[model samples]
Target: MIAVLTSGVALGVHVPGLLLASRLRERDVPVRVEVLERLLPPDRLAAVSASRDVFHRDFRVARVGQRIASDPVAAISADVQDELVRHWEECGVHTVVVFSGFWLSLVRRFMERTGRAPRVIVCHVDSVASPSFRKAGPALPGTEEIWLASRAGTALPWTIPVTREPPIQWDRREPRLLVHGGGWGMGTYRDRAADLVDAGHDIDLVVHAVEETGPAPGRTRHFVLNPAWHPWLDDGYPPLGHLLPGRSPADVSYTRGRTHHSSFDLARAVRAMVSKPGGGTLLDSLWSATPLVLLEPSGEHEGHNAQLWCDLGFGVRYEDWRSDAFSPRLLEKMHRALLSAAEGPRDLAAALSGSEVSLCSE
Candidate 1:
């Protein structure tokens, strides 16, 4: 069986792991998932679990203490090493696919300690310029490395097969906008949502935030926030479409639609997504043929990702939420660009299937 290992810390990491695992299983490939529980809190873990039903049957949860070394190559703990071996034997894992670079050193050390260990495959999901790459050192001696690339880009020599899934079909009667700030909600994102509402855009807004708690602001009539973690606020915020000024009730009613839809589903229906430049988010947008109005990069890695998005002409970048770049003309241009790119297939899972090291192999 193939084994997929992930730190389970960031949604960016966990979401891709789920998608990969699900895709593998869909292909009738036996797979096991190992989650580093210590890196993720209970709520985030719950969010990850809620994303897929396969986790209950295929996941092997474990924990590791915080790293005490500056060099990532030497950062494996005794517990983590022991757990890896245990899973290898229990699951009969012949190939270890690591989603994050943090585990590369540990896997290498395990291989050295146990000469018969399974082959290692490092899937570089992080940006090439990220600190993770710097600390993980160069690729391990015999390990196969695969870089996940967008359709507009070319993969490296060690690239695995990458394919895009077909977009979901949704009934689109009116313009809709989906706004999110990655896993951890950002206050700035909420502020931006308020700005869009003030701009008098007659579109439905599906807001996903982790920290915010309150009713919808300003002229928003059909506001729905899925409290995936918060239990107290079980019922979503009340609808105040009538409170919206300068907009007719019929307009609010026409756009009033809210359900706990996944990003993939929302991408099919929404005009565009406003989010941070994250790997998982970017891939989802590309696969769904949805346009992205990316916020400013949070760091060097995201900056690099944003550059790629711009280069591919799949999305537009705005430095600030309040910028005039959110004009009607720009949004139309971005939407058209995304649709143009969506005409072709871009499937990462199909790429993996065609690889010499197919996950289905023993």
Candidate 2:
């Protein structure tokens, strides 16, 4: 049996966990899943239920310690080591998959002691779009194999094979737009929605903000304010506090809030995805071949991602958060992205709409 372990969060890594479970199950491979405890509220759990039934129904669910869940990496690696040992022994699993932050000394020691530990694989979901090597070295020598949601120049050099397949999603329809700021809800991306609404862009708006509560802007047709969506769709917006302001509402459809639960195909069919860079949402948008408009108030990661697409002739980028820049810039680039998207997967748009996954070989 192959055991998959991860933190039960709404983030992108969960996608691959679910996909791995589904992939193994299809092959009749016995599989189980254990998550580092991060007790989710009932509503968030419901959203998770809607988006992913794999971890819930297909695989076994186990939890690590409360301290590890609350203060990972900093919570004394030895404690984590002890818990993993206990968990591993109880499961009597052969292969194990781990998805979490950087390696801890405890983890390394555990691997050493366990000797020939499960055929471990680490999957990276971060798509910050920057080429910085600071965050790329950890999972390299520590695991037997590594997978990524999108390919990067760094991956090949580092000997990490990347894959294009996203986690198995239950919903298969194209959505008008999708908006969520991540776990903290608008932690830093809240202003982007307000800016768009202030501009009168009469589009659907969905907000999963801090306190899971926020004022719904004018353009939102369907609102999911202060709510959680499964698979943590908050990467759809900028990180935190980087919203653009000033433009009048242009004619655009907008929807905000978590769609990880709904299976709306915005990533697959969005005219353009606007957000700060450096997360799975960016990769999802690219895979959908959806054009991209990267807005960054600070981190150049989003800009770098936009540059990557721009280099591929797929999309455009905007550094400032002014309404003037976004209004005209988005209008032009969104059009270009849509046009380019029609051409093929070589660009962002085509990847989103045209790409297909072959389950048997997946």
Candidate 3:
């Protein structure tokens, strides 16, 4: 059995773990996914829950909130930890994939208690050590890693596949952009949307809170992850829906996706993604063959992600796009570059399963 451990703190970390679990199950691997916050003591969980509101109100607060979640010594009861260990033992879990660094101490405890060393794969979703993995050196002893964005020590570099569908060709998509601040809705994207609209770009914008900002004619359409849904509260893929601003969520039309995530449903049809360079956004851009109009990154890791996208020609910085007058030709060139990069994406599931078959569309 393969245990995929995740945290509810951010979608960039959580979603990749879900995608990996999905792919492994496809290969008939017995998989179990555990949300780390679910194991926290009620008081600790409440504190984690309370952080979201403050974090949403300020982008800088995310770094602090994330630090709270990543504390290796965060309070999980001894009984709760043992219960998790026994569950994994009974599940016959032999390989554990770590998406958040906070889970490393748990994995270590499982080994010490059960005296079983499951193969540990620390999956890094960002181009550099993400918040969850910061200073993980002492925590991650003798673990193999899969770096989805960067080339790093003893790590197999990989690109996460977000969908089973092959990418839509460059000219096949409507000339619209999908813009959002990623899963948390914690970036400068809401502010950037005005600039795009002023520049005459048609876009689909995602807002973090339930703002009653209706769309502007000929410039924008609004979409959002169901405002009522929170990662800690719901284990399911985020309920994505077309936001009918000034109306309740019940009035919004939620998507039923073919895959675990619905964001890819919109992503594949758009010509480009305009947002912070979250690792998950990069994954979506790769699989959908959509270019990116990278915006102000939420943190240093995302800053590296934006730079990598620029270096690889998969995207351009938002300021650079502004300087270039938001050229459609630049996006087209990026789409072409993405299409080429999409061709040989390594399937992390297949690699882990020792299979020659690839999940990437042929």
Top lDDT: which candidate number? 3
Best by TM-score: 3
Residue pairs in candidate 3 whose N, alpha carbon or C atoms collide under 3 angstroms: none
Candidate structures ordered by TM-score, highest first: 3, 1, 2
Per-residue CA lDDT of model 1 for 211-299, tens digit only, reads 23245554343433343332111221112222244443334331212321244555566666777677766766666656677875545
lDDT score for residue 283 of model 3: 86
In model 2, the runs with Cα more than 4 Å from the true position are 8-10, 37-71, 74-80, 90-92, 103-106, 127-177, 209-218, 225-266, 297-306, 318-362
Between candidates 2 and 3, the one scoring higher on TM-score is 3
TM-scores of the candidates are 0.69, 0.55, 0.91
Worst lDDT run of 10 residues, candidate 3, spans 353-362
What is candidate 1's TM-score against the reference?
0.69
**lDDT tens digits, residue span 178-248, model 3:** 88888878777877888778878888887655463455557577876776666666557887777654567
Q: How much does each candidate deviate from the true structure in C-alpha RMSD?
A: 9.5, 11.6, 3.5
